[model samples]
Target: MQTKSFAALAIVALGQFIAGASANSGYAGSCTNIQIYPPDGNTNYWKIAADCKNNAGQTNLNTKINIDSCFSNSNGALVAQLNGSFHSSCTNIILTGTVLSASCRNTGGANVNTSIDTNNVIGNADGALYCFNQGNL
Candidate 1:
């Protein structure tokens, strides 16, 4: 009887250990820190965040994103493309600053696409956002 009780307790303990390990098993993402500034003329500030997603369980990511800057007067547009690998399930994104309007969209892909709009699209000297991997709750 004692041996059986000990075996059951051991099994329960092992199950708990396994559950804890799996809780945080598949978490991987790449979040690069970025600082944004207000544009010229406009006093408002703007910032952006990215939450890259991992592709499959293969542990590989091929991402290409564009960041565009459009002047208020329809003065053409400037676009910047990004390329990188994101090896995580999901990433948390946060942005803070003053702007006319800001937003983001997933578009259509494993990677996430974001956008921000300011009245003048001004860049601030000291304004930015933070992005990183989210912890399991």
Candidate 2:
């Protein structure tokens, strides 16, 4: 009986360790107050508005960042222009039947390996966007 309990405890500890190692590790920042406005430039383009901030993890020191993106349902992610000193990593923005999924990023250089459910953005309630400095790391 003692052996069985020890084995079970060891198994639980190993599981926790594996889960922690495989967890989603991000940079020292996050994107908040994300609001998508309808069509800023063309009628088929949706504008991006959010409050983002990140430490110098993957990109430069971004106290506050503004990420402007032209995302639409018909045209997908058209353009991502940011008003900061970082690279726009918003690629493959696909609007799969109202479920928009893109590698939305605003970083100088960073690498992140997380699952699809890790959330890119926050405050949207329904879904999450992985935006570290409007991006992720």
lDDT of 2: 0.34
Clashing pairs in 2: 106-135, 120-129, 120-130, 120-131, 121-129, 121-130, 132-135
Q: TM-scores of all models?
A: 0.23, 0.24
What's the number of clashes in each of the models?
10, 7
Best candidate, lDDT: 2
Give the per-residue lDDT digits (tens) of candidate 1, residues 97-131: 32222222232324343333321222211121111
What's the CA error at residue 107 for candidate 2, in Å? 35
Give the Cα RMSD of candidate 1: 18.7
